[model samples]
Target: MPINLFKKSHSRQGAERSLYLAYYFRTPTPTNPVRYHTALVVLPSPSPIPLAAAAATCAEPQSDESESLPAPTQSSPTRARSPGRATSPLPYVTTATKFHAFNVPVNENGRGRVTWEFRVERDDPGAPNTPLRLRLVCLLFIGPLSQNVGDHKLEKILKKTNVEAKYMDEFPKYYCTNWMYEALQLLVDEKIIDPLPCSPPDFWEVGGQYADRWMAENHLQVPYDLPIPCCDRAGVALATPMGPVEEKCPDDETNGNALPN
Candidate 1:
């Protein structure tokens, strides 16, 4: 009985260890994003329109005043141009839902941040291009964390999001990496930003919140027409600066897929 009593105290003396086990086994701390979303969309088209909703098939018309408003047009100037000239372009044909809001983050940095790729088309969470975009963004933004985008954890995220693994290396080659990465490389190459230690000139020691903020504040000056520029062999912008990132590859001048790799 006395030996048994000693054994019990031996377990009780380990109470600190028990508590430690409990704490170690406790649920993981929830991660909170450093940035908050603001100003959802750029209003490529005006939203919250006053048009009357019509049901499928036959529907009754609204009141006389309801039908009096002019139809939505893109060419309608959002701002002033000349004395009588129009300022805005013709209305774009958008496939976006009217009720939804586009999410643009106030800042882009946080503790252990993750990038999820998106397409202008597939607004939903699932798509083949998202992981490629995510990995590409992570790499271009910070030179690839925890190995390549094809890593196991990345594969899991891609699988969880219903993305395909086949597209791991497939990107627009221009923006094949996505917009943020392109912006990073562009700003860096332009000498608009300083470099990060052990990282590319495009990467920042403080992450992208600073650049995102800078862009957000000054994006009005950016030429929407110049989303991506094609480079010539001398690393200069060609006459036409649109299309795939690899399109500017020196070899692309002759071969298509090799892209000067």
Candidate 2:
């Protein structure tokens, strides 16, 4: 059975902020190569009131006079609503995960080098109440992996050197567990967190199809009016005259092949 490796660290003060890195991996199969994925979990300062609870509290029946008033113009500034108490603090805590995929080539000896970088940014740096604002940039290097290499050996290597690594799993449908393992080295080097064992969140169990269906069913609005594509798997397979070919995630029509700068 596979287990999730999770370690977390907390800030010394104010609203109780926390950060953790998770790692997992998928072994190679006849049709697919070895892949890894990562989750950088950040618990920012919680709001005094959860958005849903606040909305419920503010919900009121419309009056006839109010209904008769004209709708506000598009150019008019909207008024901010006052915060209300939430029955539970869980609703006030927000979680966001950024996904990345990596495909590595292993030699006959089943060894390969993995290199990658990840940049983590806080939602609001200027807010007075914001807890973590440092821009974390991690460059990773994991020498190689083979059948002979065990978790203990890997952990030792990570402690000696900090490296950064992402990708999806096949059967269990977990994101970048392998990359998360390697990224722990970064936190270790920075003295932010100590390695520990914990279960991954249920939210991490997802794929392209699940994401698309959930968002569509919820009638959620994506920022910048971007269309969300269903990525059934990590890479897209295209057929040419020669043979079938695989490529990176398909290009977004609005953004082209370039990732956001």
TM-score on alpha carbons, each prediction? 0.18, 0.28
Candidate 2 is scored at a TM of: 0.28
User: Best candidate per TM-score, number?
Assistant: 2
Q: Which candidate is the best by lDDT?
A: 2
lDDT of each: 0.20, 0.26
**Global Cα lDDT for candidate 1:** 0.20
Give RMSD (Å) of candidate 1 vs. truth.
Answer: 27.6
Per-residue lDDT tens digits for candidate 2, residues 1-261, read 111111111111223333322222223455343222333443332322111111111122223342132222223343221111211122222432222333433243475533333434333211111111111111111111233433344344443432233222223232244345445544445444432222222222322223333333332221111111111011111000010011112321222112211
Error of 1 at 152 (Å): 7.8
Residue 191 displacement (Å), model 2? 9.7
